[model samples]
Target chain A: METILAQLLNGLDKGGAYALIALGLTLVFGTLGVVNFAHGALFMLGAFCAVAFRQFITYETVTLDPTKLSPWGAPLEIKTPMAQIWFGDFGAVLINWSVPISILLAIPVMLVIGIAMERGLIKHFYKRAHMDQILVTFGLAIVLQEVVKAIFGANPISQPMPVELRGSADIGAMLGLTPGMVTYPIWRLIYFLFSASIIGAVFAFLRLTTFGMVVRAGMADRETVGILGINIDRRFTIMFGLAAVVAGLAGVMYTPLVPPNYHLGMDFLVLSFVVVVVGGMGSLPGAVAAGFLLGILQSFASMTEIKAIIPGIDQIIIYLVAVVILLVRPRGLLGRRGVMET
Target chain B: MNIFYLPRRDAITLAVFALVVLTMPIWLVPFGAAYPGLMQKFAIFAIFAVGYNVLFGLTGYLSFGHAAFLGVGSYTAVWTFKLMTMNVIPAMIFAVIVSGLFALAIGFVSLRRSGIYFSILTLAFAQMCYNLAYSVLTPITNGETALQLTINDPRVLDLMFSERGAGLPSPSLLGQGMSGIEAFYVVAVVLLIAFYIAQKIFVSPFGMMLRAIKSNQTRMHYTGFNTRPYALTAFVISGMYAGLAGSLLAATDPLAGAERMQWTASGEVVLMTILGGVGTLIGPVIGAWLIKYFENIFSGFNDAMLHHTFSWLPQGAQDVVVAITSKFVGEGWQLSLGLIFVLVVVFLPGGVMEGIRRFSSIFRNRREPGPTGALKTSPAE
Candidate 1:
């Protein structure tokens, strides 16, 4: 029973990340009616942003000692700003902060990238067929992934957790059980909490705010929104940006869970796309619910007992769920009627 | 006079195409020096693209998961080798039939939705198949992490299998060992025939209905024509073509992997169709050939090739040229593909074939100036 509980907790952590990313994806896909294939790339960029900032912050310079200096060692070198802040007191004390700070930086950067992508590439696709939009966005994704690879190389870049939170917390000990059992990483717990918070905030903003209300109205009927003089295009573009930032922020927080890589975006893109579909194209809450449900289901499928019975069950779980759901409920669990329907 | 001029241009074009296909080995001999393996790859992909074009170009439904059918065909062919004999033709036929059935199932379900929903449904199914192939279906897929031939595989249909590993007598010509390149040429010829048949179908009455449905399905349905059958026919035909291409790929390499059905692979076919000029009969083949050429040949040009080529130039100039060209080659090859796709979509939406037609018109018109321009102007004029 405890083991099951443990697995469930772990599943929730993973589900949280999946839900966050899917929520963002569904927002753009649902509202703007543009399948932004670059959403994953934006997420990757966000994670990479964390890595980049950390790399910058941890950039260090070594001063050569006359007695034991290497043949090629410089006498003295000035470090960058990040190094100065993170590596103070002549390397005696090192402060390699957690990924959260970099994630904070990613929001604005992602928003900017989202807006730029919307204005530059995706805007032209609105009038085109979904096929064209998919093609162009796919091309854009390739460009984005390639650009990252060219700049950062294909190697997976690690984003280390803070020294203080390096190891897992003993939940077992806390619960009057044996020590060192039921261990969960602090960073992962924080990620889950953070994702839930973001998801809540997005939902709150949409449910409560006038901008979101107008966007929802726009989603139902673009012409109606336009007739009301809401500047639907600009709003849609901003929504694209918001979606990008959401995906990016998810990526940033997720760096501690899964190291940021160029192809990470591609990996997440398909599953998130499935989530978007299963959640119903334009339903925000639906996306969140489906993402978590699928994530947990997938996690359960990876159990040893389940694997013993069914080979590759873990890999195909989400897809099987998707197929069944699609056949049963073509519009998804909460999809808005007539949105991208035949 | 009408008899003498009865679409002489179409006949001439057909003859020229046939002639080029017949003499490919001779014309492409020089290219073998630079790219030994590419021409064959070009032909194989051309078959796949042509098959994709049948559904996408004529029917106007853009399938994002066409590669799933192709992969299905390839896997079926490879399994036929393992279960039955090494005779490629039987395997190819089985592949087409199996993939056709698979397509029928998927299309029946997915075609219920139109536009983006349909595309997404197909995509989801393809992804599902890919995931299953990669993990659970590994036993049937040879259990090899990467698709490859193995010696220990059971040949249930091998009548001559011996515990002593005895040599059997030589088989007939059809079952005899043929080199990979010879096999490729055979497939290429078959593809050319398929392309020609597709051209005929495009101009046929059935083809007209498909196009009509694409323009407006509601109107066609209201007019009392069953649009479902036409669309389903297009889907099945395209699926079979993809399957045939897949079987050829397996026959050529004798292995199949799930990667063939990746969304990216599906996207590649779509890009090929769009880049070559959607709705144009020969455009897909041209597009596929171009992409395969770049993917296989251009990417293989390395820094060493660059350094050798620019050896005569001054140091700085040579470095600059090498740097610029390096982007088109090496790990950055996908950049070129992406750039081409974006450029073609944004600037020349009609695609490469359209670009070629326009360019040809310029030269053809320059030869005979105003009177012919007026005389040859299409109906839109």
Candidate 2:
């Protein structure tokens, strides 16, 4: 029971990430009818946002301390973090919280990127074949990752969680079970809660807001929405920005779980794409549900009990599920009729 | 195979292609690719790209898992080498049969859907194969260490024919050993045969059916033509082509690894096909050669070479020149590839073939000075 509960927690945080990335992908597909392969690059950029922010806060100034000579007889150099010099203890706090705080930087930066991508490159491809769209965006993704590689090198850069939230929490004790029985990292739990809110916020925005209704209508019938004189193009572009922001935020939160590497986007993008297909192409709710479903199934498959029966089940369960779902349920779990099938 | 009554233009094109391929070791010297290893790769991957183009260009089915078939072929060939003989003939035939079966099963399932779903399904299936080969099937695949030729126990055919040799035997054609330029010639001959077969398919009525399916599957369905079988056949054929390519890889270098089945390899074929003109006969081959050349030769260019090339410039100017050009070559070549791929897709959607066509059309128009002559004989001609 403890093991099962712990795995469920593990699944939830992973599912949160899958759900977040898939959400953005589905949104872009829904609104633009364009498959954005560069979405994973956006996620990687978000993680880099955290990395960049940390570097900014940890920027140090050095001064030679002539009074304090080292054993080697050279004057000692004192290096102080720029944040510390500017804000004292607050600067130290800023560095500690840089990962979470990077969200502020990621949003606008990712939005501009998303909008620019849509306007500059993707706009030209809208009339082209889906393969062309995929190819061009694939090229864009390579360029983006390569650019990151050039800047940060190919190695993964780890992001540090805040000092307070770094340790695992004994959730089982709080839930009235044995203490420390179902321990999970504090940040993971926070990430799950954070993603849940983001998903909710997106849902509410689309369900309740006037602008979102228009976007939804645009998704349903682009020609009809355009005929309605709403200038749905502008709103759809913003939705693309929203999708980028969502993917970025997911990356921002996920950096501590896995270090950000140049190829992180490609790896995650492929899985998220599988997640999208399993959920049904362009189906928002289906993306979320499938994300969690695959995540949990994957978690369960990785269990020693499961592994004993079927070796390497965990390595391929997600892909296997995707294949079966794609074959058995062509439109996916909640997919509407004739969406991307033709 | 029925290309015996080849069209006038196609025959000439094939003749030229054959001449170019046969004399590659000599002609490619100027490009610094004259050496046998890179030349062999050029022929091998040209076969891969050409085979890939049959299904992708003709049927418009973008299979993302074609490398799985290639991997199956490689493994089958290597297993043949382990169990039967070091002869490439049996290996090639066995590899084709196994990978064709593999493709049949996968294509049967994946062809149920079209568009993005098809791509995703193929990708998923390939990833599954990679995962299985990497872990669960490690006994057969040798996992991460990879499967290579050995001289331990069985070489049933070679043993039947002759006594055991002192060292491990290399892959051979008949009684003679194949390596270096000889191996390249063998690959080149196979590529020529594959190219001829691809051209035959392109002109065949079956090819017309596949093209019709690509253009309008719905209309074909409405006309009561079940297009799935045609698509499946193309898929299987391409799978066989990929398998052949894989066996050739094993023949050239007796090793099979799970990395061969990875989707990135599959992506590389797609890039090759697209980088050349899609749907064009020689486009994919050119694309394959260009990409392999870039990957092998261009990537070998380092800052030292760049500095030497720019030795005439002043010190500061040379440094700046080298710095700028260095990113587009060597380890940073992928950056250039990505940028170039993007530019090509955006501007020259038809690929290098289209660019070539457009460039020639300018001269043709300048000579003829009218649209009538250009229209009758395709600017492509």
Candidate 3:
């Protein structure tokens, strides 16, 4: 029972990431009628934003100390961080919270990237074949990945989680079941809740706002919405920006869980696409449901007993489910009847 | 006989293509790429791209997991080497069968969806194969160290024929060594044959059907035709071609690694096909050769080479020039490829073939100007 609960937590955490990425992908598809292959690049750019931010904040200035000499007979070098030197304790605190605070930095950067990508490149391919969009975006993705590799090198850079959230929590004891029965990482739980809130915010924004209403209407019937004399095109561009922000935030939050590598986006991009397809193309709720569903199933498949029964099931369960769902339920779990069906 | 029938111009084009491929070692010397190893790879990858062109260039189905077929082919060829004989003919045949079956299964399900959905499905399936090959199928694939030939109890055909040798046996044809220049000839011959088949398919009725599907699948379906079978056949045939290429890789060097099956390798073939010119006979071959050249020769340039090349400039200017030029060469060749691919997709969708056609047509038009000749690149002579 305890094992199942722990695995459920793992599932929820993984599902959170999948849902977040798929949400943005589906949003772009639904709103702009585009299949953004470079969505993964946006996720990668967001993580790099945090990496760059941390590097910027804690950049060190070295000085040779005349009073202290090193073991090698050279003068001892005193290194002080630029941020902490300028801002004192406040700067130190800022560096400590840089991972989470980088969200602020990631948002604006992702917005400009999203808008520029749409206006400059994606805008022209709107009427081209789907293959062309895929090709161009794939080329863009390779460029982004290689550029990041050139700057950051090929190795994964591990981001430090805040000291306060470093340990595990016994949720079993907190829930009054058994002490130390189920211990899960605090950041993982936080990640789950963060994703839940983001998903809620996106849904609420679409449900409540007039702009979102127009956007949703446009998704339903683009021509009719355009014929109504509204500047739906500009709104869709913003929607693309919104999707980019969501993907960026997901990448920012995910850094502590998995080290940010140049290959991270391509790795996640494939899984996220499978999730979107299984959830039924252009179905937001379906994407989320499929995300969590696939995630939990993956967690369970990795169990010892499951591995003994069907070896390597954990590695391939998500893809297997995608294939099955595509074959059996072509519209996906919560997909509409006609979206991308043709 | 009907399949062999080609128009006079296309027949001449085929003969010229064959001549050029067969003599690559001689012509490539000027570019310093005349070595047998690089020449062998040129022919092998050219075969891969030509086969790939049937499905992608003609049909427009952008499969993203094609490396899985190639990987399977390599694995099968290696296994054949272990279980049967070191001869490459049987290895190639078995590799084709296994990869063809693999493609059949993948295409049956993936072809159900078109556009990005199909691409994703293929990608997912290939990733699954890669993962399994890395883990559970380690016995077959040998995991990270790679599947290789070992001196063991197997090789049933060789055992029946002669006494066992003390050392590892290399790939050969009927006990004749098939390494170095021989391997290049074998690959070149395979490419010429594959090119001929591709040409036949390009002019066949089925090829026209594939083009129709590329232009408008919905209209084709609405016209009471089942296009899935045709697409699946193309997919399987191309998969076999990839297998042949993979087996050739193993035949040259008897080792198969899981990394060869990665999506990145599959993407490379797509880059080759698109860069050369989709749906053009000689385009994919040119694309493959160009990319292979770029990957091998362009990336070989180092800081010292760059510095030496720019020595005519002043010391400070030479360093600056080397720094800038180094990015487009060496490790950043992929960036150059990406930039070129993006430009092609945006401005020149027809790729290098289109560029050549445009260049030649301009010369042709200056001599004989007419409205009817705009679309055709007739011989200047």
Per-model TM values vs. the true structure: 0.88, 0.95, 0.95
Candidates 1 and 3 compared: the better one by DockQ is: 3
Q: What is the full ranking by DockQ, best candidate first?
A: 2, 3, 1
- A1-342, model 1: which lDDT tens digit per residue? 566656776877778877878888888877777777777888889889888887766766555455654556755443444556554554322335647777678988988999998888777777766666777788888888888887788999877777787778787788888777678888887877888999989888777999989888887788988998779888888888888888888898888778788989988887887887788887888888988888778878899999999878888788778767777787788887866545
Model 1 / residue A154 / CA error / Å: 2.1
Candidate 2 lDDT tens digits, B1-381: 453777878889999999999999989999889999899999999999999999888878888899999999999999999899999999999999999999999999999988778888899999999999999899999999999987784989889979988898999998677799999999999999999999889888999998888777888888999999999999999999999999999999999999999988888898888899788889999999999999997789999999999999999999999998987788778888889889988888778887887789897776543222110111000
**In candidate 3, what are the lDDT values of residues A1-342, reduced to their tens digit?**
888998898899889998999999999989887888889888888888899899898899999999999999899998888888899999988888888999999999999989988998898888876777788998888888888887887899988988999999999888787889899999999999999999999999998999989999999999999999999999999999999999999999999999899878888888999999999889999988888888899999999999999999999999999988888887788989977663
In model 1, the Cα lDDT at residue A197 comes to: 92
**Clash totals in order:** 0, 0, 0
Q: Which tens-of-lDDT digit does each residue in B1-381 have in candidate 3?
A: 664688788799989988898888889999999998899889989989999989987777889999999999999999999999999999999999999999999999998887777888899999999999999999999999999999994999988888899999999987778789988998899988899888889888999998877767878888999999999999999999999999999999899999999988999999998899887888889999999999999889999999989999999999899988787888888888888888887877888888887789787776543222111211010
Instruction: Give the clashing pairs for model 1.
Output: none
Better candidate by TM-score, 1 or 2: 2
Evaluated against the true structure, the overall lDDT of model 3 is: 0.88
Which residue ranges in model 3 land beyond 4 Å of their true spot?
Answer: A69-74, B1-3, B314-317, B366-381
Q: For residue B103, what is the lDDT in candidate 2? A: 93
* Decreasing TM-score order of the candidates: 3, 2, 1
Expressed as tens digits, the lDDT of each residue in A136-186 for candidate 2 is 898999899988887788899999899999899998998888997899999
